[model samples]
Target: MTPETGRQLRFAVLDMQVIDPPTGGSRQRLLGLFGQLGSATAYVGTWDWRGQSERKQMLTATLQEHLVPLTPAHFDAVEREAAHINGGTVIDVTFHRLAALSPGYVAAARAAAEVADVVIFSHPWCWPLVAPVMRPDQLLVYDAHNVEGLLRLGLLDDGARGTALARDVVRLELELCRAADLILACSAEDVDGFIRLYGIDGTKIRIVPNGAFAAALSPAAAKEREEVRGRLGLDASPLAFFIGSDYGPNGDAARFIADRLAPALPDTRFVIAGAVGQSLAGRALAANVRVTGAIEESAKADWLRAADIAVNPMFAGSGTNVKMLDYFAAGLPVVTTPTGARGLGGAAGAMRIADAPSFGEAVRSLVADAPLRLDMAAAARRAVERQFGWDRISPATGRLLASRAARRGPAPFFSVVVPTYCRPAHLDRLVAHLEQQRCRDFEVLVVDQSPEAWCGAAWKHGFPLRYVRTDTRSAVIARNLGADLAAGAVIAFTDDDCEPHPGWLEAARPAFDEPGVVGLEGLILSDKVGDPEWRSVTNDGFEGIGFMTANLFVQANAFHRLGGFDGDFEEPHFREDTDLGWRLQAIGKVNFSREAWVFHPPHRRTEERESLQARSRFFEKDALLLRKHPGRYPALFRAEAQWTHNPYFREHLLRGAARYGVTVPDELLDLIQ
Candidate 1:
């Protein structure tokens, strides 16, 4: 969350990029989740080398225009880098400056540890050096984006130098899993492999698969076909295309296609795409073979449009193949190696799997059988449009983030309960703020303590607000009463006096996705009256101190389960919110969302303070705490309350008993009362 403004969870991503792609892959993957959750802040760190067009082209092709050129200078300046992408994009780019081999890179990354909530290492190779120095408060999530590859390149191999090196790398990754607060695996198989390989608990691992490209050129986009095919001059020919060029497996496949596949059929022309600036050995310049340079993303569809068949003669590679999805997106019948089809759950039926020699035969077979080719093409189009598109893929990302934020269960609509008194102008302002909010999924339930006439002006505002009237003066009772009428899956309670940011709901909503997070509270601060510099803890402009009820959102079922706020305390008092927070904490986890904040105007009254003191009497008396809730709660209540300096408590409460003219029970007064 912006610390002072109290909106958006800011995350700094550390990775290498050669150029930004026009289409979204990693950028879309991360940003789509950010848009759904609306709290994540991404800081991409890329290299600055102007040379190596191959590296630049791949990065540019993959990232398009979304790439941000970041470097060691950017890393040095970053106060804290939260999340890690590891080496997912390790095509031709090197982590030269950020390598553990270099002390400066390590130091720059280590410096980010000072300011992050979570510090993730994309690979195990860097974790042993990085994790030991990070703040204890910061959570470390290892993006095992490379788990399957790590095993294929590590534990499964049987060599001395290569095996030992892979083993060390695997060991490092396993160590990261052990030390991290969370381990994120990209696939279910990877998750299982990680658990089996590292012997880590299954509960600690999260399955957040990589996202697909965002462009959804439906099979019906004939304009894309005409435009792209016209540019490539392929509309007149029976074009057989094979993408993926430079990687070891792709290079091997390209050579195999040129040397083996093209020779078998001189009547059919083969177009090889993907490599822009490199040449491979064994590439035969036969009349049937044509090696076209990297195709523009816009023209990829056209090539697919003119193609008779798409062949993926991959010899090796361990993870999910992104090209298979691209071929599916282009609506082409694909012929792939087994390695190229890994982790694509249901996409197997959409394409034919063949080895290098079989790949040549499969292409020949497709050319001979028009009906089989047509069926496979239809299946590929349906598979991509239905199951492999970004629209289908992004929801899983949302669910993952939401699960992490809420930490309990699935997401539900939030009922934001605003308890108003005599402040009509403030209520109007709050209402206006609420109306402008980004997440409009929440319902506004305004529980007014005053007469209907006082809220008449607010009633005319025409916002979709549900009004509930109660003569009860106790804010605690009103909040609890509000809970009974709340229809949302989650209940957010904020005071009428506070002015929330437009993104407050946007920021807090994602925390619901976190595992074990049943309750979400944000940093609350006095609105504009405090010292500007000293107000925010980190000066990212967030009021980092309070988690007031005025800015708290709770799951509705959990809220009702805890019975809402206790009304025994005085109206507008301090301990009531803390009491509710304690109760909710007893039932499930309470997450402090740095992003979900509201601006509470500084207002305190002695009557409210005295009433709060009376509530503290109940908390201080161990007997009352024991009787009110079941076992194992009083101790936690004491700890969190003490740790946060519960406003209702005073050191004097521990000593005074007879002064109140009441005989206190020994258990309540004795033992650190």
Candidate 2:
């Protein structure tokens, strides 16, 4: 866990403001990651001055808390002036300055990266100025928060210079990606966009979603709302609040609610909050429309807690809506435009949706029906608690980054087919190991015959896995069932009881690359074998045949060509795979790879060994396969009567063998005749 120890990942977020720090969803996520990887050094680059006021209040306070004071020097004088004005102020002063002064920022971050193992330059909007100065390393990560500047420069509007710049920015970011060891994005949408835009491999990108902040979650004082409501003299009215005012979309939302909706519902008062443009704030306000004009930070949560409904009439924006997430955490029902709820994915069930035309009606309906409003309120709270909260998000984020992120190559994207019956313990281990794999372009198909357990943990691991249920049991049939749902280009087979080597794919992937190789065999390295007498005693006891589908890989298209497993081979037991291997060999090659190995857990007892199918059904199925594919095993079916007195089987096998295209071997046939 030491910074200089094994595989250190240094994060250099240059030009990422430290003052108000934007206090947006992205900041919350960065803080969460910092908490998770406490070992990594975070180099935060900022403008010389944040702001006169925010510097005094937030920046100074935070710096004073973390850094010790010293006597003034020449550089200290500059630092004092810069610190006084370099924070979260609304004016473009800090950002413009930060954009202009990135030389110092680059120097600081690069210095930090020298001693560190990884270098990450992020905040696409801010660090373009510093991109030229960054040093290349084995682990460089670029975080693309948004493609905003392109949209604003009118270049993205048409085939102008901005379009060229947008194209260049995308090209540059891609170049940066190829130069780095890994890349991170806040959403899967961003990750996918970068892949398409930059032509980087999809495996290189990892998604770490923006997290919620504590300010949104801490309960507000009930009396704070009472004071604000009393000041507006609307104590009798039900409150509904809106945040974000300076942004054009925020202003439009304010007007939409005040002009279109406030007249319809006099009993409900709409409070337009946050720092507003002077002109927009003074625009035609109704008696029930209260412009709170950016409530004090301390009172923001109180206002959210007081509101019966929160409205977000956003017309444009990308990325998850931080305000909506904050509202949901406060347990308040919301009426939001489609654009406002974009990317959260769970907002449809959590909020009331309304466009500009229906906006007024939607707000009034919720105001009139208290029960409907309260139900939505409860749903929103549950959505936040279950899916959107930081605690829930952090764990999933950690699993993906630590277990599956930063892997790319010519690795075979294979689907693993695992069939299980009452093997919950084995199923859990298989999934956990799959999740931990350094190479993850694979799907796990689990066929479960355990009606009692319902594949409890296997389905809950949050990976690319599928589960199917069946009552009748046959290992071959179960495997065939799993193949039906698999989506990967190549199929890898492993039994529920086997533990694949970490490099199993690294070793076996080449077989698929081999021309005309259809079915490849994987060795089952078992330390313990069932008793030989017992293996012999069980009818069709190829359970010890030891070739596991559990460790085999096949081309999906080729597996489909073999018509899946021969279901007619019902032994509650054997010959299904041997029959399958030979038939596939008839079409192509079946090469064995000693390199591909899996450890089959020690065998269990006879009582545990028996599958639940009745003996009568087992005998019928064994008879059916022997009849259908007699050409593959001619001697066993034809001479059954001469050597052993199984009259029913001999009669069926001879009639069935002739019915099919199988010819008895001449050497054995002469003796039998």
Candidate 3:
């Protein structure tokens, strides 16, 4: 919860790109920052990238995972006609059209905004969808990868049409700055650009530099390097590798190298890698240059290993050079224009800055001096491994997000639903625990099933309490009824026989608010005396959190969507909660918390009751549970026939059957064995 408003740090994430494969630096930056944040907080988002239906959620362990699908819009002829008439370039027109979100996405975002504490727009382009839906008190964040208004201007030719197009982008960017409560700029240079060009407040900006997965890269093995060089049909001479996507600046840089730099170094082999090579495909080039169009990552790694040097000739662009980090990670010394080395404090000497006029000289110097290459390569390796890895750099942004996010939103509210039978003592003990709770933003709902209210007419509590008497004796029905009458956004269910910890409600609030999480299972510890006779231990499996009704918290929205546990399972199968828990996993994450604990004592029963429980007919509930959740039953109950029951309890059940002169069926007898 926030230290100021005391709200849980929940997020409604918005993105325009898919980050699972993360093809470029911008995508990697997003995944490094927001993807890791899923480990702690609840976050949900949407992306309208066409044919991205395969990605249901961001690639990570977020509140199980859910994404509201947004419609993908493309630039059409009508939009082009309008752009032509208005004197706007196709680049700006395409951007403007793609930024517009469909009504479906808007509605979902509005609903998410209502409940979430923060709204994150990955880039300013798609933020128009979020602007109108934001609540006044909600914290809004803008992740500025580049000074986009200035960047787009460079994508087009120098003319009034391009300038006019840039002007519109500047206006939208300014609007984004005004809406954002916080801004994450890629580098200090980007921070200055935002303030200088758009006049954004410097106080709200943070310098979160781009990162690479450095640990995944390594210097190539000798045999593998030889094989790769032989396969590419390149000579043993100094091979300079330059890889880039088909962005405008990358094409210009590629053309510059093919037209000017490569011809100067006739003895050297320059391999132009990735989509940028497509721009140089048809052009007449030097015999020493080789263009490979858009290779796979493995192939890219191969080229990085085979090459003697890494080169980037880019002279224009905003944001830090993500590809430069790859060079550092691969133990390659880089020679690039100053623009290509942006954001990394000269990359700790990994990159040697040189202009286009002297590009050939820098390569010749590195090729002539082997020790210089080794020294730069070592520096590059150290820079990536020690400081610039995604694992190393992502935490700072997460911490900033948490600290700033903690200052907004309201305290979480819950409706504690206690279903009681005839045990007034157990109900009293449970209520006493609730009264001493550290977080007081919840109400108690006592759904009494006992005849004439066995909780007593004199029952009382400090907070607001609702005592509802129901005729239904079924646990499923009682929970469903309590859910229907629940006023709080989250519905927490605890058995009358269980004593919840003082911090149970408080511990559960954060998990419920986590992205994609619908159900929260807490640790239900055993507080029983007669272990062999009666077993109530529930804290065994559940991957860490148990789903037993003795301790469970369900988001009211998800609970209602699942119809609050099928009441039919209440009759013969007393595993309604278990069935519901398994089904809930199909929709969203069902998380477990070790902190929210409940102590359940063994119930004292008659010999007749014990015999009835041991009968073959009574074991049908297990078969019923198995049929309802066929796939998850094994994991839920383990491979054992008698799940959760100890060996002593199994023996006791068998003994009870013999004492009552009852013969167990062959199938039922296997459970005791």
Q: Name the top TM-score candidate.
A: 3
For all candidates, the clash counts are 38, 16, 4
- Tens digit of per-residue lDDT, candidate 2, span 534-604: 21121122322223465666766556544455543433444456566666677677677766666666443
lDDT for 554 in candidate 3 is 83
Candidate 2 residue spans exceeding 4 A from truth: 1-9, 19-35, 48-102, 125-137, 149-183, 187-201, 214-233, 277-279, 394-399, 402-412, 415-423, 426-673
Give candidate 1 misplaced runs (Cα > 4 Å). 1-8, 22-37, 48-120, 123-139, 148-168, 214-216, 220-227, 235-237, 276-282, 369-375, 408-673
Write one digit per residue (lDDT tens) for candidate 3, span 1-673.
4677654567666654546566777667766666665333333344433444423543665431335444544425325544653633353334434534455545655666667777777666656766676787777888888888788766643576556666777787888887797777766557767877887755556556677787677877779889988997767888998988878789888998888888888888888888888888779999988898888888888889888889889988998878888888889988888688766642434666678888878888777778778877887877676546777566545545665665334423788888777878888888888888887998777888788676343566776676767555656656655664555678888888788888888888888657999888888888454355554456555443226888888877566544466533443325677777877787789988889887877544445544435433434344445544655654544444453544444554444343221344555455456
Q: After superposition, how far is residue 67 of candidate 1 from its true place, in Å?
A: 8.7
For model 1, what is the alpha-carbon lDDT of residue 446? 77
> Residue 212: error of model 1 in Å?
3.0
Ranking, TM-score, top scorer first: 3, 2, 1
Q: What's every prediction's RMSD, in angstroms?
A: 22.8, 17.6, 22.2
98: Cα error in model 3, Å: 5.8
Give the local distance difference test score of model 3: 0.68
Off by over 4 Å in 3: 4-8, 38-54, 63-101, 108-114, 157-161, 407-673
The C-alpha local distance difference test score for the whole of candidate 1 amounts to 0.55
